[model samples]
Target: MVAQLETPILSSPCRVPYTVEGLLQVFTGSHRSFFTNVMAQALRIAGQGTPVLVVQFLKGGIGQGHEHPVRLGQNLDWIRCDLPRCIDTPQLDEAETKSLRDLWDYTKEVVKAGSYDLVVLDELSLAIKFGVISETEVLELLEQRPRHLDIILTGPEMPKAILDEADQITQIRRSHRP
Candidate 1:
């Protein structure tokens, strides 16, 4: 269920400035998994005036020819950075590493151009864990983000420093195993 805030401002038509800090606090209070929906609602409401950046960190199965139904309904621009292709996996050889790094570098350059309203670094946590991308690079990107842009980071095991600096942090814990 979605937790409703009682603040009058929340009801107002004005765009609400949601930070990572506020979202973390809210998550601590309720165990509801409605953050994505809530965020979508908030963005829908806020989109009245300013553009909303809805960054999504997805694991595998992104470019497997199946279109994402949920993402299709959204109104913002969608830019996907295929994690497996962008990063060096354990199975990758030396030649693959160079190719992956090249891809990563190219993608980062595009991201640095600041064209999209929302930039989704899909499965970035795993990329960082696997040493495909550097945490410092992400920090720099966040620091240099455009003033009007809203950044969202998703994936498993986000770094503490990143979480602390984020305006919001939501941890999705699963019960059933694959």
Candidate 2:
């Protein structure tokens, strides 16, 4: 959902900003058994020669995750939003609530700046699901973001709007073995 603004005529020809191709990758599952692998692959492939940012909600780092210990590259940037560990049970005091909003604002700034080539919104679905941030707000930010910016959103219970807007969607479902 890209918003097109009216181009202002300049006395001299205005320098047109370089339009970069962007893609959104969505990953959802109750059990992210392959979250790290998918994330690592994304980083390994797209993260080269450009900056990558990971905004983690609930868990801080790869090591902090409950699953396998995932190793991150040196150049990757990490921003952890302190949300309740479980979406089913959210415990947020006034301070944490403020912090979550602050983080959301900060993420908007980063995305708007178009500084990073790739950005991963880890567990962002949970944040939206739990009302930490509104889906409409996020959608607006995404719409206004630079074309060159590529984004990846991870977590369970992704909204239909998000899924609809995503270029690619991966659902990692855990099967019940007989």
Q: What is the C-alpha lDDT of each candidate?
A: 0.49, 0.70
Distance from true position, residue 52, model 2, in Å? 0.3
| Candidate 1: segments with Cα more than 4 A from true spot | 1-89, 175-178
Clashing pairs in 1: 19-167, 20-167, 20-168, 21-167
Best by TM-score: 2
Model 2 Cα shift for residue 168 (angstroms): 0.1
lDDT per residue for candidate 1 within 46-157, as digits (tens), equals 4543333333333223542112213433444433333444433456556545544654565456456755444444455656677767889877867766544455555557
lDDT of 1 at 158: 71
**Candidate 2, superposed: residue stretches over 4 Å from native:** 1-20, 60-74, 82-88
Candidate 2 per-residue C-alpha lDDT over 1-178 given as tens digits, one digit per residue, 9 for 90 to 100: 1212334555666655444478888888877555696567556744454667777665632233222223356556666654444334466667566666777788889899987767788888877877879999989988998887788898888899999999988999877899
Indicate the residue-level lDDT of 127 in model 2: 79
Q: Going through the candidates in order, what is the number of backbone clashes in each? A: 4, 0
